[model samples]
Target: MQHLSRRQFAKAAFWLPTLALAGPAWAQTGDDPVEFVESQYNNIYIYKRGTQVSMTFGHNKRLYTESVMDTTDTKALPVEYTKFMTAAVAYTKKQDSILQIGLGGGRTSWYLHVHLPDAAIDVAEIDPVVIDLAKKYFAVKEEKNFAPVAMDGRLFLLRNPAKRYDLICIDAYRGPFVPFHLLTKEFYVKVAEHLTEGGIVAQNVEPSTMVFNAAVATMKSVFRQVDFFPAAGNVVLVAYNDAERLSDAELLKRAEALQAKYAFRYPLTDLVKGRREPSNPVKGQILTDDFAPVETLHAIERKNEKWK
Candidate 1:
């Protein structure tokens, strides 16, 4: 057996439990079929088990599931975090235009596209391979209103100065960690610049990471109201420039209205109930492009954990 370093061990420990929790029913069977496997920006693996298809990226034992979809029922969002991400709709009454930083299996985008047929959806996926896989296996299709561009999210935002969105979702992840550039305060400023009035940004953040507090702090520095929806092993952050924070009653009312209109597979009302108070006096420093040490923070967090 190859000797694993402490970091490797910690990463394995972190992912193993999540795999057990988030993985499809076939995960325990050990008979899942590999639909595709390739190496590019990351080692990518696609698995198909029954009606479920999943995309995972990583090297060796450090694998992380990026996206999962139920092929038989596209609206049935299998991942808990994706369901939480849909809660972003409650924050904005008009989703005329939406910008999603990462495509993943295109589950979230597809769900939104189905429910908000009038909305124009733009997806930025840095990896063309993932986009191709999403179309080939995940039932993702590009139509007149839906556009998936092959480009880095930050570059896409930088290049399109005039484009604004009613909602912006930052679910980009390289394995379990967000890209360093995407986590910085500067990157968030660019994200905020692209939002239309009353627009909101929803991000999927892994709270287990040491940079979690810093990520929240960075968003607080840029946006006036930051709300949290904690899901299994992840937290979905809803941040906007509103002067007054929406009360639970208000959010619940919006959620009820959305639910009545769309009747989403995952109830928006249940997701809204997951919302909790933000951490007061967030502990970490605001992450700037010049000083965001995300990898270092992850290492420190792992080092502090008591490994059995």
Candidate 2:
């Protein structure tokens, strides 16, 4: 028996299917589609083609397409920073139930699982292939407390109501865009209805795109306080339905408290508040299941590539 690296197998498998479609394209078995395997705190799959490279990470027992860098909860707070600690402590200390929409690289969720040993995690993912790859390469199945469901995220939330979550994380997207159904104000309302009082919903969104504004507006329409914070090139949307004030001062205080306990690189003191884009000049439209022009944002992202 020969030991084959996960990348080797994935390249062979992906190329084989692709060649079959193109009527016998390149079939060199040794051709490496994967650029490299990055294993630090988390396992990263870097696949290459011509000039374009795609990065993937395993989370919640699933393989998710990722941006080139580790953008985890950076939008909310740095993974090595105390912002996450403050967010977790602020929202989830009292509840044991957490629901996650997308499992990407398992970075944020993995931290949550490790920190909250007693919490019940429910994950919703639609792609079975991603799940299979994650189990084999990403150590997703090792998360014993996680329960994964193969279904549309919005549909799952609408159908299931057995247990209410204290913290809801929405990070699901289709390629470079989030599903339209998941971006509507009604969707936020449903997420709110499913939460325990004072519960907060945190979402990781790309700020270079209009989807960020749409998501924020939707969250504001439903939640009492909709705030956005920058982490690298992404933004984390934090929405609290209660009248609690997450002012800069309050957030900083919590970040300091968490730093004393976690000791992360670049304390929360380094985080700069992100200003909401001027939606006043540009009329914003509601993203609906019927008419979400998410693909349009891809064009915008391409033009703004220099900004990233």
Best by TM-score: 1
- Per-model TM against the reference: 0.87, 0.65
Q: Candidate 1: where is the Cα deviation over 4 Å? A: 1-33, 278-281, 302-308
Q: Candidate 1: give the clashing pairs.
A: none
Best of the candidates, lDDT: 1
Off by over 4 Å in 2: 1-31, 34-89, 93-95, 255-283, 296-308
Per-prediction backbone clash count: 0, 1
lDDT for each candidate structure:
0.80, 0.56
> Model 1 shows how many backbone clashes?
0
lDDT of 2 by residue, 154-190 (tens): 8888889666888888877654457778888778878
Worst 10 residues of 2 by lDDT: 73-82
